[model samples]
Target chain A: MPIIQINLVEGRDDKVVSECVREVARTVSRTLDAPLASVRVMVNVIKPQFFAVGDVTKAESAAQKDKS
Target chain B: MPIIQINLVEGRDDKVVSECVREVARTVSRTLDAPLASVRVMVNVIKPQFFAVGDVTKAESAAQKDKS
Candidate 1:
């Protein structure tokens, strides 16, 4: 079996997480010809300061507030 | 809170996966000053053919057999 792990800042609703997992999994499954049953997805949440986006932590979600 | 997503090929022993999670968590916790409890880790495994390493899939594990 193949598993995929994705870690991102928390706070996203279950819908968002579920959508992401489905999208990535679907893409990979189609591209690799792997069955959906064989694909596994897992998520990890970390503190904003613990992750860096372009060398900057998501803790600066405030700064990015206006960007997205 | 922040979450990071890492997607890679499956088949790694639990020890390797455990070490990876622990190391990444430890590093991020220390660097960002987050407590270990705040860090959540999840793993997903993708079929070798589903994942690309430097533009190549891990399915070529045989070709890479002699490399590592």
Candidate 2:
């Protein structure tokens, strides 16, 4: 059995989340040659502060001027 | 930053899920030597019919007599 999970920022509505879940599940089933019934998908929506890149939370980075 | 997602059967109460998430995040943070703030966890609760082993869905197999 294959279980897939996607992590992204929170904002999408129910419709968008549902569509994303379906697409992810379909892709996993197709790529692994597994039965559609055997694939499970979980979507994790996180607040911007909970995720970071390069020692700076995405929320903090977004607030500051472009460092590059 | 590390994101962890766990896939398991549904029916767990909110408390169980929260504790699971915290433990997972803690382990990931410690093992990776990453900041605790940088770890994110997502729990995916799936239906029995959606996960299978040996080409048979768990739900179906459970309904039948033990084959072993």
Top candidate on TM-score is: 2
| Number of the top lDDT candidate | 2
The runs of at least 3 residues in candidate 2 whose Cα sits more than 4 Å from the true structure, single-residue gaps closed, are A1-12, A15-68, B65-68
- Candidates 1 onward: DockQ, in order: 0.15, 0.06
For model 1, the stretches where C-alpha displacement exceeds 4 angstroms are: A61-68, B1-68
TM for chain B in all models?
0.70, 0.80
- Model 2 DockQ vs. reference: 0.06
lDDT of 1 by residue, A1-68 (tens): 44666666766677776766666555545544568777676767777777775777777765688688
Decoy 2 TM-score against native: 0.50
lDDT of 2 by residue, B20-46 (tens): 666777777888899888776655567
